[model samples]
Target: MIEATGLTKRYGKTLAVDNLTFQVEAGRVTGFLGPNGAGKSTTMRMILGLDNPTAGQVLIKGKRYRELKDPLRTVGALLDAKWVHPNRSARAHLRWMAAANRIPAHRVDEVLDTVGLTSVAGKRAGAFSLGMSQRLGIAGALLGDPEVLLFDEPVNGLDPEGILWIRKFMHRLADEGRTVFVSSHLLSEMALTASDLVVIGKGRLISQSSTKEFVSRATENAVKVRSPQLEQLRTLLVQAGADVTDSDDGVTVSGMDSEKIGELAAANRIALHELSPQAGSLEQAFMQITGDSVEYHTGLEAEAQHVLEPTR
Candidate 1:
C-alpha cells in the first residue's frame, strides 16, 4: 500500500502541492484525477523521491521510498515515456536498469514480452512511435515485478485498441492484489477502470472516495416526463415539491423517482406522453464537480460550440 500523510510541496513562492493526505490500498485501481496544473506530476515525483517534498511525508509500505531496501521490487512507476535515452535500444535500456539493481538478465526479456515490445526490442527507442514508446516505458516499470505500480497518463498517445488493452491490463494487475495508482484526466476511461477515485485541484484534495459514491453524489436522481400540457405538468411537479426544469420536449423532475412521478401524474389526471429516468453520464458528473477547479478557462472558445437551452 502507498500512503501520504499531510504531504506538501512548494517551489520558491508557489505551492505546487498543499497539505494533501490519502492512501492507496492494495488490490484495486485508484484513479488520480485533476485538470492540468493540478500538481499530480509533482506528487508522483515526490512519491518516487525524485523531488523532495517541502513538508509532510509519503510512504511506500509504511516507509519512505529512499529508505526502501529493495525499491525496484517494491514499487514500479512510469512517470514519463519520453525520459528514455534516444540512442539506447529497448533491450539495452532494461539491461542497464537490471544490472544496476542486480536483477537477472532473463527478467528483461520477460518484461519485454509482457509489453509486446520483444519483436522490436533491438530497435533504438528514438524510432519508436508514441504508443510503442509508452509500451516500452511500461515494460521498464514491470522489470522488477513490483507489487505497487504508478502510471501517469499511461494512455496519452495510445490508439483505441491500445487504450482498451491498457484498461484491461490495469484491472488485471489490480486483480492480482497489486496496488495500481494511475493519474489521468480521462474521466470516461477512469469511470470504466477505477474502483476508487482521488480528485485534486490546485494541489489540494477535492475528494477521496469510492467510484460509485463519487458518481452518485455528483449526479442527481431525476425523471423526464413529457405531456401535452407541459407547462401544467411543470406546475404540478413544482407544487408537489419537486425541482422542475423544462427540457426540449418535456419537463425534468428532481427529488422524485420515475415511478413516483408517474404515479403523481396519474393521480393528477395529466396525460403523459413519455416518462423515463434520467441517468447522468460520468462525463457530466466530472464536469459538474470540477467546473470550478479547472486551472485554464476556455469558456469563450467553447461558447461558439455551445447549444442553447430553454431556461426554466
Candidate 2:
C-alpha cells in the first residue's frame, strides 16, 4: 500500500508535479494515466525516493520509503527497462541487482523463469528485443518478492503477446493480495488490465475511481436511430428534446435511449431501418479529458495571439 500527500515537484520556473495526492490500496492494481509531460514520471520517482519532492511526502505501508529497513522487500519498482547494461546477460544483470540489495542469488534464476527468460537468460541484453528487456526488468523487480510493485509503462515496447502477458501478470499479482501500481500511455490496455484508475492531467488529479465507475461516468449515453423516413424521425426526435444530428452514416441521437427512440419512431409511423446504442470507449474518455488541456488550440484567436507574441 502507498499514499502520497501534496506531492509537488518543480524544475526551475516550471512546476512538473503540482500538489498531487492519491492512494494505492492493497489487493488491486491501480493505474496511473496522463498525457505526456503530465508529471507521472516525476511522481513515480518521488514515490521511490529517487527524486525528492519540492513540497510533499510519499509513504509505503505508513512509513517514508527511505526510512524502510528492507526497502527491496517492501517495494519493487521497474522505472525503466533500459536500466540494465546492454552487454551483460539478463542473469548477470539481475544477479548484480540482487547483490546490491542483499537478495539471494537463487532469486535471480527463479524470477528469470517466472518472466519466461530462462532459455535466453545467458544471451547478451544488447542482442535482446524490447519485450525481452521489459520482461527482464520485471524479473528483476519480482526478485525481491516485494508486497508493493510499481511499473512505469511495463508494456511500452512490448509486442502483443508480451503486452497480454504483462496485463494478466499484473492482475494475477493483485489477485494474490499484492499491491500493484502501473503507469501507461495506452488507455485501451489500461482498461483491460486495471480494476481501479488514477487519472491526472497538467500535473493535477483528474479522477480516482473504480474502472467501471470511471468508464461509465466518462462515457456519454448516445443512441443511434436509422429510418427510411428520415425527415419524420428527425422531426419527432427534435420535438422530444433529443439532440439529433443527421448524417449519411445515420441519425445520431443523444439524451435518449434506443427503446425510447423506437417508440417515438413507431408512433410517428416512420419505417425503421436500424436503431442501436453507442458506448464511448476508454480511449474516447481519455481524449475528452486531455483534450480540455491540449497545449495547442487551433482557431483564429489563437493564431492572432501567436502572431502578436514576440518570438523567443
Expressed as tens digits, the lDDT of each residue in 50-102 for candidate 2 is: 99999988999999889988798889999988898899999999998889899
Q: In angstroms, how far off is 108's CA in candidate 1?
A: 1.8
For 1-312, candidate 1 gives per-residue lDDT tens digits of 999989899999999999999999999999998878888999999999999999999999999999987788889999999889999999999999999888999999999998889899999999999999999999988989999999999998899999999999999999999999999888889999999998888999988999888877877757888898778778877888889877888788888888888888788888889998877655666666766677776876245213221123
Q: How accurate is candidate 2 locally (lDDT)?
A: 0.86
TM-score of each candidate? 0.88, 0.87
RMSD of 2: 5.3
Off by over 4 Å in 2: 226-231, 246-250, 265-275, 296-312
TM for candidate 2 is 0.87
Best by TM-score: 1
Q: How far is 285's C-alpha from truth in model 1 (Å)?
A: 3.0
Weakest 10 consecutive residues, lDDT, candidate 1?
303-312
Positional deviation of residue 91's Cα in model 1 after best superposition, in angstroms: 1.8
- Number of clashing pairs per prediction, in order: 0, 0
Show the lowest summed lDDT stretch of 10 residues, model 2: 303-312
lDDT of 1: 0.88
